[model samples]
Target: MQVRFWGTRGSLPVAPKAGTIADKVADALVAANGRSFADKAAALAFVEDDLDFATGRSYGGATSCVEVDMGEGPFIVCDLGSGVRELGLDTLRRCAQEGRPKEWHIFLSHLHWDHIMGFPFFVPAFMDGAKIIIHAGHPDAEQALRRQQEEISFPVPFDWLKADIEFRTLETGREYEIGEVTVSVILQHHSHDSYGYRFRDRDGKVAIYSTDSEHKIDQMHDENDFAQFFGHADLVVCDTMYSLADSVSMKEDWGHSSNIVAVDLCHEAKARRLALFHHEPTYSDADIQRMHEETIRYEELTRDTDALEVLCAYDGLCVEL
Candidate 1:
């Protein structure tokens, strides 16, 4: 199983800085990982002129989105933030190049605007005979998508979308199957009710995608629930939208967890790998590096049990399990 981050910034998209060391590292990492570094570099270059490592300004844009390819018959995507626009275009190119019809399954955690704003811009919706299934926790799943189709907001209507689309409203705790993947949904604590999903392939490779959730004061009180929900997960993508200090101060009850809290959850759940996700919009790449270092330090401090390997998530980051 493989997971690829199309966009990682929470709440908004962040722009690239000119000739920054971090940008170079990011480009190098993409090349090392078999992605198109030249194209990425070109894109960054077109956006900036001066190439300073320090004193460079970091830019910001849209929210969270990710794609998970199980190497099976169908592809699975999480959330539908502005990142989905790129995901859709890429999917179209891949399908045309392979001469196959597009087949995709999208899992939505909730109907928040930041999570669904890119749906209309998604290129696949414009293709004829494309197959897309949307699975979400909203009781009014279709309504949520339809709300974005109003003439006041968009020139095109949902009915005008050319793809063959299906919407499935899921209930909490129900397990469902798509091709070789089995997915189970769990309720999470958020501003409104949200969902955390667990996907297990036939080979027992497990992945849990849980974001937009807040940990209660009795942090470990529901540990057993998560243990059962995410037991033995190979990868866990969790919400870590705040620092310990920030979370303890004003961000508490903001429906998000701090890095430490997410790491603790990974430990309690016995997850093999934990990917910190849903970055705060205000956090720069350097800020993310500091958070990553702190998370690593904490992971090492609690490494006696070897519970989980902690890492941070960035756009275009990919993980194989």
Candidate 2:
């Protein structure tokens, strides 16, 4: 199984401004001052080894769409954020090139605008003969989606869509088989509540997607049911939308977790890998990179026996398990 992140930001999308790009260019020039290279490879090597990731690359701007690849069949995705538009285009190209039927399974955490805003733009939703299954814990999931495409907001009404779209609500803790994958949902701590999904393939690879959820520091040491939900996951895609201080001090009950809390939860859960997700929207690329480094340091200080692989999720990141 492979987990791909098409978007990673929380709340809303954010693109780098012109001034940011110019700053990076200027930084790169200053770093290269009086330096000579024999070939492009040498210059590139220097940049890779010396230059900061924020100065050369971005964590990206798209919000919450993720693709979970499980061999062949219909595509399975999590959330329908702005990034889903790109996933939709890619799916269209693949379907057209291979002459295959278009089908998609979307699992939504909640109906927050950032989570469902991309559904209206999903090309498959507008294509004839396409099958789209939307799974959620919210009973009004279907109504929320339809409301987004109502005549008041979007030009195309939901009823006018050409695809065979169906919405299903999953019973918490019940496992459902979607193709060869086994999926289980768990209620999370968030405003209006959210669902965290655990997907396990036949080969025993497990991936947990838990976003728009918050955790309390006082709950970390206790034996938690949430840890069981994340147990032994090969990859735990978690909400890390704030710093530890902020998540606890000022943002209490804001329905978002910090990277430190994510590490603690994954550590308690015995998860093999932890991917910091749901990045704070106001955070710059540099801030995220520094926070990622801090998370690693914190994990090192707190880890007991097994070492967990830690990574910061970015748009276009693909992890194969």
Candidate 3:
């Protein structure tokens, strides 16, 4: 199984600035500090230096979408945030290159705007004979899709989309077969009822995706329940939207997890690796790096038995198992 992140930001979309010197300086300061360039004053000075940015352009600032290719039949996508627009276009390009009909499956955790906003922009839905299966926890995934295509909100209605679309509502603890992969869905604690997915390949490789989940200290203390929910996965992608300090202050119960909590969950679940997702919009690349370093240090001090590998998710980042 191979997974690719199309967007990693949380809350809203963050677009790349066009030749903005301030943005360039912020990127350089972040690189130099090896952390997020949080100090606005310092970041501005770096921008004034006119640093070159061939490497910076590659890290796109799209929002919360992921694509997983299970190497069996069709492509599997997670969420449909603004990043899906690019994923859709890329799918079209790949289909054209390979000379095959488009076939894709989209699994949605919830129907939040940021997670489904890019559905209308997905180019493949306009093509005939394109088979797209939408697996989600929402009561009416089809209704939500139609809402986005309303005349008041969009220029085109849902009926205009030519692709054949199917919706399947998944239940918690039940496993569904999609080609050679078995997917297990679990209901998670989020502002809205969200579903976390576990994918087990025929070869026994496992990947669990549990984004938009909030991990409270009390909840973490209960090892039996949480471990049963996330245990023994090869790769677990989790929500790490706030630092412990930030979470304690105003972000408490904000429907997000801290990096420290995510690390502990990985250790508890005995997951081989933890890919942190749903980054706060305010977190720059440097900030994410700092969080990763802190989590690693904490894990070492705690002597986490799993020795889990921790990584921050980035747009276009791919991992193969």
Candidate 4:
């Protein structure tokens, strides 16, 4: 199985301002510093090797959608944020070229607008032969989505969509087999209650998708529960939307975790790889890169017997399991 992040931003989508781009350009030029590039390849190499990620690349602006592909079949995704529009277009193109039916299985963390707003723009949902199955732990998931598409909110009504869309309410703690993947959910700490999902394939490869969930640092809970839940998982996608200081202070009840908390949880859970997700929208690419570096340093400082691989997720990142 493979995991792809279509969007990684939290809260909402954001774009770099013109001033931000100008700064990157100025920084790059300063880094070049009187060097003469013989050709485009030389300049490209300089950009790739010498310049920092903030100057050369961006983490992107799309909010919270991910794709989990299990070989060839229907598609499984998490969230339907602004990024899903691009995913929808890509899926539609692929289906058209391969002569395959459009089928999508989407899991929602919660009914948050940033997470569900892309559904209205999902191209496949407007197609006649497409089939969309929306899964959520909340019983009001369907109604919440429908309300967004009502006359006053959106130009098109939910009932007017031509696709066959169904909503399924998930039962927490119970595993359900969806195609070749075994999926189970757990209630997470969030307003209106969100869900964290664990997916285990037939080969026993595991991936946990946990977003919009906050972890309590001061409170003591049975470590065994989380350890068993994340037990030997190959990858854990976690919310690291704030700094530890912010998470504990001003944003105490913001329903988002910090990289410090994420590292600690994945370490205790014995998860192999941790992907920092649900990036704070206000953070620039450089800020996130610095945070990633700091998280790695923190992990080293707190390492126990085992080593955990850590990475900061970005839009368009692909991981094979």
Candidate 5:
């Protein structure tokens, strides 16, 4: 199974300013310390491996889209955030090269505007002979999508879409066999509620996608339920949108989690890896890198029988198992 992060931002999309880009360039140059690489490959390697992620690359600004491949049927996508536009174009290239299917199965966590805003710009929906199957815990998913494409809101109507689109309601706490994978859903705490998904491939490799849900820290039962949902998983993509102080005090009940809480849950679940995801929009790449470093340190200090590998998700990052 391969899980690729198309978008990693939360709430909304944001772009770096000119000064930020200039700063990265200056930092990269200073880190070189007057040494020059022999070739472009060498220079690129130095940027990728030596420099900090904030200086060498970006965490990206698109909101909440992920693609999961179980090596059978169509690829499963989580959310349809702004980054899905690029994913759609890449899917076109993949289809041309590997003869992949034109069918897509998109699972939505909720009916938030940021999560579904990219549907209008998705090129595949404008193409003929394409099939799109959208599944969500909310039965009103279709209504929300159609409303977004209304004449007053968008120039194109939902009925104008060329691809055949369908919506399916998913029951929480039930596991469904889809293609070569078994998918389980868990109800989460959020505005109007949200749903987290767990996917187990034929090879028994597991991946959990849990975002837009607030985790109660003092509640052992809630923690246990989430831990079970994440048990023995290869990867757990969690919402780490704020500092612990912010998540608990300032943004309490705002429907988000912190890296501290994520690490604890993953540790309890005995998961192999935890990918910090759904970055706060106001945070810079440097802020996220610092948070990532702090999370690693926290995991090290609180580790039990085994250590959980910590990863910060960036756009275009691919985790293969």
Candidate 6:
């Protein structure tokens, strides 16, 4: 399975200002150190190879939508954050070329505004013949979606949509076949409660999407159940929205976790790779890159017999499991 991150921010969507963009350009130029390029290709190559990610590219501003592809037909999406709009546009292009039926299976984590805000702008949801099945653990998923599209909020009403949309309230802990993958949910710690999904294919490959979740210090002692849930997964996309100091002190009960906790959890689960996700909106690209470097160092310092790969998830990132 291939997992693509459309959005990875938490709480809110934010973009860099003009000053930030200028700073990146200035830094890159300084690093070039007056070197001359024969062509734009050579300069582009230098930027790609020499410049670090934070200086060369952005982490993006969208919040929490992901795509899970099993190399099959059905469209499987996770969350409906602002990133979904881009995915929706891309889906339209694919549908236009392939003439495939517009069927989407969306797995929601929770109905936070940031997580559900993209539904109104999702192009496919506005198209005829588009069948959208929103599978969520929350019974009020449809209610929340409809409420967002109310005239007071959005110009377009939910009833005005051209597509056929269905909401399926899923029972957590029960295994269900959703197209090419078998999925199961585990209740997570969050406001109004969030759900973590485990997707496993016929070949036994597993990819777990566990975001907007907080791990308590008291609960960490009893994390064997979570360990079992994450056991042997190829990739575990987790919430790492704060530093250990902040998550424990100032941001306690804020429903977010730290990269330190993420590494510890994945290590205990024996998961192969952990993608740190749900970045804090206030953090600059450099801040996130520093956090990623720090997390890698922490993982190395706390390594067991086998090493677990750690990566910071950014928009447009693709991971194969």
RMSD after CA superposition, every candidate: 5.9, 1.8, 6.1, 1.5, 1.1, 1.1
Candidate scoring better on lDDT of 1 and 2? 2
Off by over 4 Å in 4: 36-42, 98-100, 220-223
TM-score of each: 0.85, 0.95, 0.86, 0.95, 0.97, 0.98
Question: 249-268, model 6: which lDDT tens digit per residue?
Answer: 99999999999999989999
Q: Which stretches of candidate 5 lie over 4 Å from their true place?
A: none
Question: After TM-score superposition, what is the CA distance of residue 272 in candidate 2 from its true location, in Å?
Answer: 1.1
Q: Give the whole-model CA lDDT for all candidates, comma-separated.
A: 0.80, 0.91, 0.80, 0.90, 0.92, 0.92
lDDT of 5 by residue, 111-202 (tens): 89889999999999998998999999999999999999998999999999999999999997688877888998998888977889998998
**Model 2 RMSD in angstroms:** 1.8
lDDT of 4 by residue, 122-218 (tens): 9999999899999999999999999999989999999999999999999987998888899999888899999988999999999999999888677
Ranking by lDDT: 6, 5, 2, 4, 3, 1
What does the lDDT read for residue 190 in candidate 5?
88
For residue 286, model 4's alpha carbon misses the true position, in angstroms, by: 1.7
**Which prediction has more favorable TM-score, 2 or 6?**
6
Residues 1-321 of candidate 1: C-alpha lDDT, one tens digit per residue:
888887677766666545555666665455445534368676466335433321233322456788877654777999998889888887777776766458889999888877888898988888898899999988776887888988999999999999899998898767899877999999888876789999898889998999898875456676668767877899999989899888878888888888887877777777899998888987776777778889989988876586578878876678998
Query: lDDT of model 3 at residue 265?
Result: 80
Candidate 2 residues 1-321, lDDT tens each? 999999999999999999999998899889889788999899889878989888877899999999988756788899999999999998778787876458899999998999999989898988889999999999999989989998889999999889999989899869988887999999998998999999999999999999999898877755387899999999999999999999889998999999988999899899999999999989999999999999999999999989989999999899999
Q: Ten residues in a row with the worst lDDT in model 6?
A: 216-225
- As a TM-score, model 6 comes out at 0.98
Winner on lDDT between 2 and 3 is 2
TM-score of 3: 0.86
